[model samples]
Target: MIRTTGLTKRYGRVTAVDGVDLHVPPGVRFGLLGPNGSGKTTLVRMLLGLVHPTAGSVELLGAAMPRHAASVLPRVGALVENPASWAHLSGRANLRLLDAAGSGGRRRDRRRRVEEALERVGLGGVDRRPVRAYSLGMRQRLGIAAALLRSPELLLLDEPTNGLDPRGIGEMRELLTALNAAGTTVVLSSHLLTEVEALCTRVGVMDAGRLVLTEDLAALRTPTGLVVLRTRDPARAVDVLGRAVVARSGDTVTVRADDPAALNAHLVSSGVAVAELAAQRRSLEQVVLELTGPGADRVDPGRADRAGPPHQGDAVPVRGGVR
Candidate 1:
């Protein structure tokens, strides 16, 4: 539902986003992950028509941007960075205003939408409370409610889980999952690797103003391994499986294997412990580092590796337009 070609943005002599090409299919939860100053927010603004791109084109829901932004924006809901909310207004009042100004819903319809949105975000009871009096989590939920007011087909959330506690984060995850299941296309940008691993089906990693890698979540998972044994001697079992280097806390001996069942049968006939065995896979964080290059653990894992060879047609220079 979203596509970009050669999308570039620059400030003075520095390019914040360079020839970014992205494609997000319908109902897919695509993630834009990058470290600070990697141009994630800038790309988002360009997509929303809030910032003019220096070059290239963006299309959303089959319509080109800026020229068709007004027509397309109603179908999209966005919470970029921190939400803009009036401190003095009640939560319900804020949503009501958005409904009126953006969607032009009637009084009764707007009220119902406001109430439903608040309830969806778990803020039904505090709808009457002023936004300033609400906690940060509450305010974040309120922002989400406002974005949902129009029943948008596309939701763009930038760091939606920022500042949220564990409980709040879980709540947000559940909410977004429910939305995607209902056929809403979601594009989320987050610095939290664990959250992305849990929530996103596909991800695009950006660094140095370019996309480094894009992959399905399943493909990124480390392969699982299994092992087997035969002899009852624990010492012999350890010795068979490289005992000196491999550490065994209890009954199980941990070793990397491609086929656990095969290894188990082989060990059983070899006079090793004929007991049970299991397999373990590396975490998502490790896989991410491996794909994006080493030192990613210390550097921002989200940063795209733009220093590599330039993508096709990306070398073509273009001029920036007026805001």
Candidate 2:
């Protein structure tokens, strides 16, 4: 339940976010996908009133932002960038402190919320342990628990799976899925396309401070579907399938045609022997790169120098980490 129109943000002469429009429906996990310095964090901050936009408008839960942010934000929970916690406190204690400060619930209610959050994030048994003793995944879960302290209606998570191992990532995915299924609106900003593909029904891709494309994940799929045809003579296959392009290994030819079956029939009739014919589904990463242009993998040289060389630990901040 969020909408932005011509949303623009600038820093002096540089426009970090430019004229982006976004619409998110209720109870959906929408993904904001972009590389570093693509204005994803800037947009999220503007939505939260953490940063004021130079132009355009933002509405959250049907109310204009900043003017109504105070009332609306209480219903919104966010974990921006990397997870943050008081290193000395236990996981449960960290959430308890937040609950005491802003959650407005009683002791028993707060405790139940903490435990449920921990359980949802797969950290139930370990909530008694100090945060400093927890691993990166645990800390991430704790951050999520803190966000859920008040049973927020909207969750804004940035790079939620940044440092997790495979299992931890899967758990995070499952948790988000369940949250959305239970009617929580989730806006997840991430550079990991595969994770977004699995979690989000809709995706927005940003580049050079502007939203280049927003589409349902299903709409991004090829109209004809993808086909990978293998033949004894790769050269002949390419010649036979005029519209096809040879994939990375050269032996595999990828084709996007509206009628793959007809193409197969034509190839067979043309005496082109096909050793293998399989559908090649486009991954979210491939579709995003295609829509955002070929240089999607290229990082901003300026942000790279400013953020410093990447470390082994999490580089993203707990909130608005990209700044």
In terms of TM-score, how similar is model 2 to the real structure? Answer: 0.80
For residues 1-323, write the lDDT of model 1, one tens digit per residue. Answer: 98999998876566778899998889889888876556777777778777778899999899999799778988888887777687898988887777777767578988999899989988888846678898888878877887788888999888898768899899999999999999999899876789998999998887767877787877766565534333356666777667322555556566667777776776777777566666665656665555443322344556644332222222222111001
Provide the overall lDDT of each model, using Cα atoms, as 2-decimal numbers. 0.75, 0.77
Tens digits of lDDT, candidate 2, 1-323: 99999998766566778999999989888999987767787788788776778899999999998799668877888887677777888988887777777656678988888788778877778846678898877777778877877677899987888778999999888888888888899899998888998889999998877899888888786444667887777777777777556452556677766566787887788888878877666678877777663333455555432121122122223331111
Scored by lDDT, the top model is 2
The positional error of residue 118 in candidate 2, measured at the CA in angstroms, is: 0.5
Model 1's lDDT to the true fold?
0.75
